[model samples]
Target: MASFEASVQLNATPQEMFDFLIDTENILKISPPDTGLSFTKKPDKLYKGAILEFQIQGFGKVQEGTHEIIVFEEPTLFTEKQISGPLKSYTHEHHIVPAGENQITLIDRLEFEPPGGLLGFLITESKLLDLFDEGFYQRHQTLKKLFP
Candidate 1:
């Protein structure tokens, strides 16, 4: 069980932030440039029951993942659970909170278990956290550019 959380204040309304998140095309814009995150199968907008198939080839590694949208709340929250991926289990929640009259707070939460049961040495929790830190920093920069 490992977890990562990050929150960024954006100069946009909750609906605005939510709209950006639900758009599949915006993903590549916010993701780390070298991650090469792309969808093999996707929908224009995200909603409960929507499934996503994606692949990333970067950091000197390549991997594929599939996730199911388990929860969707317009202008507020969206959650996805990994159906299959590098990790044994993975869940991500996107929370959009009203920050001010014309602003919103975007929060990202992730919980997962690295591959392997007792011998998950290939990917460590610390390493994952570091990766998340770097990824979110880049994401935040992009969000700021897009929203501000």
Candidate 2:
């Protein structure tokens, strides 16, 4: 298993930060448009057991997958597990912690294990890790711009 984590502090209230982070619409806007993500199921309110399906377009093909909310805590933490996807297993956990009265920090932790153990290690060491690093950095920048 390989782990990738990124954290960013924002000058916003925890509630405010949570609102933006939990919103799927905001995610789609900040995500690369070329990814072609479409939510199959969206909830009016966020909680445990929420399900969502996304289609990612890459290399001239669309890969479809669904994620299930495995852990949820209001205004603090939320986690989702990839139920079906290209990877063997994937889980993304989001954490929001209050820094001060009007400041908050967002933490994103992604733990994934791909198929073909040896091959997976090679892939992560080669380009996939860099790709994830860049993606998270861009996401943090986008959040900073959006929140700060």
Count of residue pairs whose backbone atoms collide, per candidate: 0, 0
Best by lDDT: 1
Best by TM-score: 1
Q: What is the lDDT of residue 112 in candidate 1?
A: 86
1-35 in candidate 1: lDDT tens per residue?
88999999999988888898999999878989778
Cα lDDT of model 2 by residue, 49-120, tens digit: 878788877435787788888887877889999999767788999899998878888898988876556655
- lDDT score, candidate 1, position 126: 79
List ranges where model 1 is wrong by over 4 Å: 117-119
lDDT of all the models against the reference?
0.89, 0.78
**Residue pairs in clash, model 1:** none
